[model samples]
Target: MADDYIIRTEGLTKQFKGFVAVRDVTLNVRRGTIHALIGPNGAGKTTVFNLVTKFLEPSAGRIVYNGDDITGSKPADIALKGMVRSFQISAVFPHLSVLENVRIALQRPTGLSFRFWKPDSVLDGLNDKARTLLRDVGLEEFEPVMAGELPYGRKRALEIATTLALDPELMLLDEPMAGMGHEDISRVSALIKTVAKNRTVLMVEHNLNVVSDLSDTITVLQRGEILAEGTYDEVSANPDVREAYMGTGHD
Candidate 1:
């Protein structure tokens, strides 16, 4: 499926004031591929995510998703088109039960117009679906627990489950492994691999080892531009990437 890239960006850029946060970064994330974006601090990795997810409008360039141009589309509109993002921070409702959190996300896609009448059957069906999602992320045990009370990793898993409710074709994850301990990281990594089996994932991560393990392709960014892009070995072997990783006077 290399020839059928699900997401493509052509000279995509984002500028804030006089500073360019993302510069002419063209990329192709092949269908069903796990593409990892890695770079040092201030390398504009998160900015690229922002641009791709429509959280920030691009200053220039075009974005093609499933071969359709969506460069300037609004975030909600883009999400409705089967592209969704999971932020670095958890977006789950703190007060809602774990199952309810996922249920709310499921409700978004359905045109639920009848609010006054009791939705007993609808609620039951949604409950079953939400449980399935929780089970997917290994959070089924905490379905009745308050979302805010779950462990850090479990909270993150809930967030991912909520995102899954959108049934996204392309999922943009910003540092999914952020703030996780070794055990938590391992769990999340497994969950990521499971989810990626059916959805295309493009993640920005700082852990090189994790990137190498999870990515079918890798892209290195520096100062708001793409430094290199290829498989782990190909990009790691690139002279520019080595220099970027080594930093000045370190090599």
Candidate 2:
């Protein structure tokens, strides 16, 4: 049963300058599931993400990924272990074409990373694979376009394409639907679902509608602790969860 989970945190906690951000949290993400972590602002959602991804060292507790204890691992180390994360902000090279951006991501696995001096032809081998990833995220038409020239939603799609190029087994998405209109939210939500069919996803999201539609399970955090976790229907009906998250008018 333990092997069913791709990542697990036991008694995870974080402190900043004597202030506790996450406290005694034990989270489990099953393989091949879309799990959403939702809470109001300042609920330590991002802090939990940082701890799991090794962006910030846990003040106390342990993190296990794929049966290995990785509490003391660095961010890059986790990434190398098939755990890749995307930031809340769009993180694409502004000047690069969409195809070039994904090709760059593909380079790391081929031992060509940072060898910018290698002739452009050296990277031509990566183009077909990059184009396939672009088509996967519905950006095949934008491959020749500049990443920065994309509209907000398209840029997010490009970011997903680049993230996919890394061949991540566990993808951590931080606020993937922030600052979007209704249409953009619908588009990206569909993309997340498509990409998550085979791999696992753990996302920190504020949009309950998106969470309800896509999440296989939901974990609700409040004041740096898990308030409740279950299906969207189960947690939505809990009075305590309603008061702490939905009652506050958070969608």
Candidate 3:
């Protein structure tokens, strides 16, 4: 049987100079599903992601992934364990082709310097795998195009392809749909759904429509604490959740 939870945290907390950013926040992300973490600004969603990824040390908490304690693990350690976080800060190579960008990520497990010393013929073999990832993200046609020249949404797709090169079991995306037009949103929403078919996804998105459509589970936070946790239909109907969203315009 599948593990009860792929990722879990108990009493997770973060303090910034005595100000609590996230406090006593427990989260459970089941294996093989799309889970969303959502809240208004300053509600500590990203902070929770940081703590899970070990990007920031939690003030007090235990992070367990696949039933192992990872609270003291480093960022790379968590990544190696199949938990990868795609930062909101962007991961695309502005000057490289889509194929080259993905190949670079594919070579990460193999040292970059070693690849540099190998024959161009051997390096060319990475193209097939790169193309497969591009295909998965619907960027196969753009493989030879410059990553930066693609439209914003396509660039995001290319970034997602780069992340896929690592073959993560649990993918954490921070604001995957941050700034996009309706067309881009549709394309990306479709792409996210496609990639998430086999792997688990945990994303922090402000788009409630996407949340409602993609999430199997939703955890709502307000003022650094969980206000509600359940299906979209369940949480959206909660009076307290409605009040929090209405008061802060969370969606």
Candidate 4:
């Protein structure tokens, strides 16, 4: 909230029984910028995400979004505030056509009662907007394709389109490049850049190359705490980060 930051966490910490997974972390994600969270395994990158998304509650700390305190808010509550997370507990029906998947997402904000139960024709009115979203994500050609049948990278694109349907001001992605081949990685990386033009993106990704190329700011974690924070060059040049990755031999 301070100085255009869309989300900020102060003194964030989490523990399981007696073991701490995240500790006294303070992070700020600037609006309309791509921020990456990176660390070796067990560094608590995912835990920080889980806490922010409200999938897990922090043992101590506060989460602020757009200058409002949302630490005690529910997952749905934060999502409604335009902080939609990719892989957002929203299910994409595998059997549905890609367009249909996006259409469902487009219908989410209506708060209509059992609207999905209505006849399929009832959704014709939304096709244009859904198609526009498809075009926005480069999934226009695959609109008719079954979501389950699309190639891996295109499927990720569709998932992004669905999230975009909610019109989020801030987007959180958990491993946007996970399980991607070289080609898919490039494609999805480009798509993420395109989609992030007017929106803020916060992602947890292991592909440091993608982070190097895409992140406006990078935050590095180690043993459940922040070790480095800066642009790609700064974080990559940090001796502590080099030691954490190479000395510990964690990929």
Using lDDT as the measure, the top candidate is: 2
Better of 3 and 4 by TM-score: 4
C-alpha lDDT values of all predictions: 0.86, 0.92, 0.86, 0.88
Residues 110-182 of candidate 2 have per-residue lDDT tens digits of 9886466788798999999998999999999888899999999999999898899999999999999899888
Question: Where is the poorest 10-residue window by lDDT in model 4?
Answer: 242-251
> Would you estimate the TM-scores of all the predictions?
0.92, 0.97, 0.94, 0.95
Cα RMSD to the true fold for all candidates: 2.9, 1.2, 2.0, 2.1
Candidate 2 versus the native: TM-score? 0.97
What is candidate 1's lDDT per residue for 1-251, written digit by digit as tens?
53599888999988899988888999899989899988878999998888888887889998888878898789988899999899999888899799888988887787663332566576676888888998999998998899889999999999999999889988889999999998998899989999999889999986666677788999889998898888887877788887787753122
Number of clashing pairs per prediction, in order? 0, 0, 0, 0
Cα deviation in Å at residue 227, candidate 4? 0.7
Lowest-sum lDDT 10-residue window in model 3: 109-118
Per the 3 Å backbone cut-off, how many clashing residue pairs does candidate 4 have?
A: 0
